[model samples]
Structures are given as structure tokens and as C-alpha cells.
Target chain A: MASPPTPLRAPEHQVAGHQAAEGRLGPLVDGAGLFFKPLQGDGRGDDEVSFYTLLSSLPSSSLPSSSFFPSFHGTRLLPASDGSGPHPHLALEDLVAEFSNPAIVDIKIGSRTWYPQASEDYIRKCFEKDQRTTSASLGFRISGIQIRDGSGAWKPDRGEIRRFSPRDVRIALRRFVSSDPRSDPDRALAAAVYGGADGVLAKLGELKRWFEEQTLFHFNSVSVLVVYERDAGATLGKGKVKVKLVDFAHVVEGKGVIDHNFLGGLCSLIRFISDVLTGLDENCI
Target chain B: MASPPTPLRAPEHQVAGHQAAEGRLGPLVDGAGLFFKPLQGDGRGDDEVSFYTLLSSLPSSSLPSSSFFPSFHGTRLLPASDGSGPHPHLALEDLVAEFSNPAIVDIKIGSRTWYPQASEDYIRKCFEKDQRTTSASLGFRISGIQIRDGSGAWKPDRGEIRRFSPRDVRIALRRFVSSDPRSDPDRALAAAVYGGADGVLAKLGELKRWFEEQTLFHFNSVSVLVVYERDAGATLGKGKVKVKLVDFAHVVEGKGVIDHNFLGGLCSLIRFISDVLTGLDENCI
Candidate 1:
């Protein structure tokens, strides 16, 4: 007695230049809070599949807590939204399913996204992109952002987010936590979401700590997906803010060396958020 | 039946000018790895008793994990080490009991140790002491330190630790992790103890995150007891480094306000330790 899957209604925050073509089966969600992402069939897809399988097989103690990433349900063959032939899709926990009005941002962390094994052409492409974006200077860049306003309507900035200057990124982050992105920031909610015990910044600190010590996998071109219920009351309760590490297609073995590249980017992101929090505090006083 | 308690042979790191007389029962240890701290009859002791009782009564979910502090086993009237009269003592987990050669440092955190409720004279006394030590400038002061040398003997530096200049404090911290404190810094151990996953810095970061959000209590005049096995191999295993928040006599209720004083001190200490790690890395290179 299960119903057929439906197209995901919420905005699909995808990497720049990687959005699914119009009318094709993109992401689907069922009533059970399961999200189905159609596999790209590219090498990256296979790498992600392998990474998930390796993560699932590893002892839980050796890996970061399962909460740090979307809970993987397994790969499945599912029909597309247009009722086309079954294609492989990744089933994962719909992180924002419970939020009535969720604000989300995908920040790609790292100054260099290309791996050591990448081809010269790929390296050149990534290097050019890095230099053109905020990543070269800040070690991170906002890939996508969507915030719900007072009336519960989402205002999404997708393409422009990737080219945001450092100042633009700061403003965008401030707007992400604002009650109305079109207006002034909501100081109280900003404090609660950014500095709260379970806020975005605290969660990032936890992830940073894990990265500092974890010698298992080197995460390259990974995005930290930050989501929060914008409509939640001023006092954001426990678990209101959700931060997950996504886009692991570029992950590599640690080989007994610490992942300084990833750690550096994470620390950079942390500093940015901390600066945002400090600015909010000063403005209030 | 359990055997009688034995005098703690390890150097007792106490508050400056507060050391017990040579013949007095300062601290005791049992085979069960329980440390018995002889309570001072002063008001500070009563305050500590109340704090521990309050901590024990609070739901574990409301407080930081018990691992952040010595596990309180309740206050009890215990016989003195010299078979004298039984006196009240705080029974806590012996943090360094398992280490055959432990290096320990008690860094008292907070720029100001006196609370608003203290008498004018007491405030003046605390102010003078704060001004005289690194607490005023660094937000923390090394109250005591003991590092085990190659001969497995403790090199106790108690009184002078409290008077260490900022630079001296950094040197002392570096020495705390060095295999041979009498010689050059042990780059490998320094990296392992300061930057390693379960090392002192990571644990402090955890505590800092909790402090940033928790409104349960304002920790005043707290001491972060850092302990690690000096003899642990290059790759210090999990649980080799132990950081515990101790000395709750000056703790006050949070009253819905973040403890900025303690948080500031902790962040300062973290920066210092991070600098040490960075220096060690540069030296190795």
C-alpha cells in the first residue's frame, strides 16, 4: 500500500552547471521522508556510490557519527517522474522534510577541488574555477542558497552564489538567518542559530574537530549543506539546525596523512561564521 | 573487604599558597582508581559540595557529558592517611591513575576569579592576584604543572608556574608535552598531544562549544586539568590525553547568561595550544 513517488517540490540546491535538465526526473520524495536522487551515470556517481558503500561497511566507531551525513538508504532502480524506464537513484533521508519553511545553503569547502589523480585538463578547469570564485581567497564558496521570507515564500539565489565576493558571501550568510532576507537581519534568531549549542557554527565546529583527527578519507570538493527551519521560534530548539557533509565524489583515501586541505577549508568556514556571529553581537549592543 | 587507603605518592598540584603541611592528609588514592580530595572547611568547600550535588541531581542531558569532569562519587567522611579522625572528602575519579608516568598541568581559567557576591576585600585580593599573574593578560594562569622526565621521575613546578609570563606559560605548555622537558621540544609528541584527535586541544574545543551555548552555570575560577601519559608511544592512542574541568568552588548559576569569562579564557588557551602545534609543525618542516 505505498503510493507512487512525486517530484520534489522544494528547491533542489544543486552544484553550479549540474542542474538536471528541465522535464527530466530530478529528485523525488515520498511520504516517508525518503529522497531519491537520480544517478548522473558519470564517473562521479560511481565514486559516490562506492564511498557510501564503504562508509556503510566501516565500523560506526571509525567513521564520523552517522548524523554528519544524509543517512544512506541504498541505491535503487526507480521510475522517473515522467514514468520513463527505471533508472538507478540514491535513496537518502530527506533532511528538510520536517521543516515547514527551511532555509538552506550549500557551501563548497576547499581551495582546490581537484584531486592528485585528476587529469591536467581537469586540474586546469578546477584551478580556473577556484580563482574565479571566492574559494581561492576564502577556502569556501556558497554554491546555492534559498531562504524563506516572513510570508513563508522561498527566495533562492542559485547561479550567482558561486560568483559571490567575500563581502557578498558574508551578507548572504547574514541574510540566510534573517527573518526576512529582503530586510534587516534578525539579531536574536541569528544569535540562536549561529551561536546556539546546536547551531550551524557549533555543528561545523564538531565536523572540524572530526576532520582534524580523522585519517580515513580525504574529502575533496565536498559541500557542507546547512539547513535550518527559518520559521522556528527565536529559541531554536535542539536539532533545529542541520549541517551535513555532502558531495563526496572526489573523496580519496587518507593513506595515514591528515587531510590538511579539507581541515583548512573547514576552519576557514568556521572563522566566517564566527565573524558573522560577532558582528551580530556587536550590532545588538 | 576492601583494603585501607594509601597516601597519594604523586606530586599534589595545589593552588598557590594552599599546599597542605608535610604531615597532613592532602589527598588519598585507593586501588579502585578513586582520588580522595580532603575538603577545606572554608566556604569554598561548601560551595563545591553544593555544585557537585547540583550537578549530580541535574539530568545528564542538561549538562555537558560527565567525561568533561571527574566523575563525582559523592562526598563522604573518610579517615585520614595517618589513621587520624575521619574528615569530609570529595571522592572523584583519579584522572591520572592509569598512567605509569603522567604529565599534569592545572590551568586556572577566567580573567577574574571573584564573583559579584564576594566581599570588597576578597575582590581586591583576587584582583591583585589576577593582575600579578597571566590571568589578566591571557585569561588563564598555570596554577601548577608536573612533567615526568626520562627517568620516570616527576619534575614538579608548582609555585613558579603561577608566576609564569605569557611567553613562559607557552614554554611551560610546550614542555608539558615534550618527552624530555629538560631538552628540546619533542615535535612528534607535541603534535600528537596538541593536535591529535583525542588530544588536549580537541577536548578543549568540545568544552568550548558547550560553554558557548549552555546557560546552566557560570564557571568561575575553574581549573582545566590537562593530563597525558608522557611515555605513550609516538601515536598516542585514544584516551591517552585527558582534559577535565575541576575546582567548582567558585561556580555560579548561569542565570540564562553565557559565561563569557570562562569562554574567553578557554578560547585564549586554545589559541595558545594551537600556536604551539603550529610552531612544532614548522620546526619539523
Candidate 2:
């Protein structure tokens, strides 16, 4: 009754940052809203699967509202986009599907992506990477960014974003919101997308509040995915800008302790966005 | 087929603070979710009516979401509870109608309640009151508060709250969340209600973000009404704790200028609540 899934084209439509290096398996889409991410055969895939399953079973009251994460629609077996035969794929709501043209940024939060239970090699690898990026000092790093230009084409920055310094990260964020060169020079959309009721900052504040008290999981290497419509005349409305948690392969049980690592990084990100808002205001003055 | 409207008898259920002094007209309910607030025949009532009416006509995209204010249900002619015959009332959504034994606080935000267009006598009166209360220094003052005590009885603190100093305001807020003595010693409800998504702080943050950029109406003498269930076992859930903007009698057109007066008071209130949250965490430690 339905057509087989097709590979998600366009770099802007795919998960940006770390996935670029993985080069193993890419995600698929139904051309509809469903996003099918090929599950890794390693334990990482099982870990993510279990996390989503556990989240599904827990009372929603005990967790952040569903909007904070991609809506889980269970796992599905699908033909791999790479023609690697049928493989188990995670069925998730496409974060950017609703937008005509979207500007997206993938930020991996936390100063450390290694947990106490992680292998020594993994810890060392993550530590080196953290030190090389702005994450070590600023508690967050821009993993990837993609924004549409005046001509209605996507301009994605991945290599430079991954290596961005703190100042560069700030500039990258500004660029993410200020991309459509044809828009108003004042960049009102920045405030609307980053500071509105359902904007990225508000959503992050909600997640930070939950992280401050939640004793369920210690999320390592998780990404805060921000997406917003980049159409020339777009203004913030309901669901105009989306902020969601993705990539939970490194999650561990909280063991009744707060996730200070994640919380600190989140606070840093909030501060940066707040600064951007203030800067925008000062510039207008 | 419908029952006649009845006066809201319980003091805890009524709008606290300024209403206690007004004593002119009070709100009524149909035992349903609709709140019928008696409109003053004076210009103040017409001002509020105009604001609500204008708000109703605006596309929701152009204003803060309706949840920020109680859902306006248009005007209605109702028989006053005091047997004042039929009077025009602003029928609004009853914010606390669903809560069981709710703890409510009415905080009048802004340092200067008097507007440029107000009579000199009114300005002097408001200035004197602001100076006497914590509002002059702290940018906000507790207008009234009602919380359930250990015995499950309402404890209305009006006089003391109205005249609360900054220190006293902080204590009053702490007590508002920690009212149920039989609950967990750590006061998880404090973080849950004040820090959770859709909680008072989160909602205030949303309002602040909107105020920072919006050049619509300058809200003066308005109250940020906070309400939550004080039932011993109550936990945060959807629509559990409500934070709303109320009493727009002094609102004025912004004329393309930001409402710095209201914004300053909002930030101050946010700081105080953030302090309460931090102090709560220290006490638990």
C-alpha cells in the first residue's frame, strides 16, 4: 500500500556534526514526516533503543514534555538507503520536515562526553576532542550548522563549525539566525526564534530545569538540535522553531545524582544565547 | 438548562492583594470554569475591556499566546453577587477553577503604577504606596497570598504580604511552595513548581522574552498571578501550576517603544524566585 523509503538528499536534511565522520549508514525518509535512522549494529544502537523504550514506558509527568525530544514512533525494519539490505531503523519525527526552508544547528553539550563507566580509550578520545573544541572551556561546541542564503539555497558549515573557538561559536550562532540576507537588517527573526515562548532558549531553559532535578539518566554526547524556518518572510508562530534532544547512545543511569555535566553545559549555552539577545538589543539602540 | 451564577465564596479562590482593598466589585462563577469579573463603570473598566477586546482581534502570531493571559470569553451581562442588578462583566477563564486546595499569590509588578496620562493626585498616591512597599526597591510587591497549612485549611496572608519588605517577600514565596509540611523534606515541589517546564519561572521567562522585543502595550499595575495545587501529594503535571497576567486596567499603547518599566519588574521577580530556588537547594544539601 506504501512506496519504499528513499534516501534523504541534501546535507541540510541530514543530521550534521558527528554523523559526517561516521560515514557508515545514513538515514531514510518516507517523503512524509517520518525519519528512519539506521540503527548501529554495535551496542550503541541498543543503548539508544533502550533509552527511547524506557522513556516511552515512564510516566510523562516524571520526564520533560514530549516536545523536548523527537516523538518516538518505535523502531522499524527498512531497506538501507546505502543499499546495504534491510536493517533495523529508528523511526523518529523529522525535526525539520514542517519547514519550507530551515536553518539548523546541532550543538553537542557538556564539557566531557565520557562517563565514568566508559572505556579508557573512549574517555581519552572524547577528552582530546573536547579539548580541541570550545566545549572544554565554554561547555558547548557547535557541531554543525546549515542556513539558507538569499538565493534560497542551503549553505552548510560543518568542518569549521566542529573546530570553532568560543568566539567563532558565537559568530556561528549569529550567522545561523542571520542567514537570509534578504531579510530585515535588524534581524527580528533572531529574537522571535531564539527568545519567543516556544523558542530554542525557552525550550533549553525547560530542559535545564528538568536536568537540575531529574535522576533518571546522565546523558553524554547528546545533541541539542535547533531548527527554524528560514523562509524570507517567516516569523515565529506555533512550532516555528524547534529544539529537541537527539543522539542518546552514550546515556547512563543517573543513579540518583544530578547530571552536573549536562546541566553546566546547558547553562553555558543559555548564557551565550542571552548574550546574543542583549547584543541584538544594544545594536538596535 | 443552566444553573444561575453564584459568588465565589472562598477567600483563597478569589483574586488576592489589590482586590481586598477595592471591595467595590468581586468576581462570580457559574460553578463552571468561566470567571465573570464585575467591570467597574469608571474609565478603568473601559480601559481593561478595550485591551481584552483588542487582544481578541489580533492574530495570535502577533501577540503572546493566550495561555499567558486567562482565556478571554468576551463580555456578558450578569446579575451582581451583591444584588446590584445586571452589570457588564468581563467573562474570563477561571485560572484556578481546577486546582484542589490551590496555593495562590498575586504579585503586582512594576515600580511605578502611575502612567504619564494619570492625574497628579493618582501619581502621588501610587508613588507613596510604592515607597512604603518593597516595590520601590525590588520592582515588585506581594499584593496577596493564600496557602494551605498542615491541617489542610487555607491560610490567607493579606495585610502582612501587602506591606512585605524584600526579605519578607522572599520568605513568603518560600512558604508558598513549602506550605505542605508533610511533604518530602527536600521540597521537590519547590523545584517542580518554580523550575519545571510550564512552571512559574519558565512562564515568567517566556513573558520576559516577549516583553524584551514586543512594542505593543505597556502594562502597568498588572499582576502576575501564580497558582498551584497545595494538596499534600500533588506533583507537577500538565496545567498543574498556572502563571498568568491579570488586571490590565492600566495598560497603555506602547507606540513602538518597549515597556522597560514592566520588564524591569519582571526581571526582579525572576531574580527573587531564582534565589529562592538556590536557597532551597542549599537547605537540602
| Candidate achieving the largest TM-score | 1
| CAPRI docking class of candidate 2 | incorrect
lDDT of 2 at A70: 83
Q: List pairs with backbone clashes in candidate 1.
A: none
Cα RMSD (angstroms) for every candidate in the order listed: 17.3, 18.0
Most accurate candidate by lDDT? 2
Instruction: Give lDDT: candidate 2, residue B2.
Output: 32
Candidate 2 wrong stretches, greater than 4 Å: A1-12, A15-24, A152-156, A179-186, A280-285, B1-285
Give the runs in model 1 whose Cα sits over 4 Å from its true position.
A1-17, A81-84, A152-156, A232-235, A280-285, B1-285
**Tens-place lDDT digits, model 1, residues B1-285:** 133356444335333324445666676667457877777776877888889888888887886663787888877687765457887877878777788767788888876676666787987799679778977556688887877656654445565665688777777788777767767756557777878677888889888778766657878788998877766453467888888888888888855445656765676678678867878333312
* lDDT (10s digit) by residue, model 2, range B155-209: 4466666667666676667777774533433444678788877788888988877
lDDT of 1 at B10: 31
lDDT of 1 at B55: 85
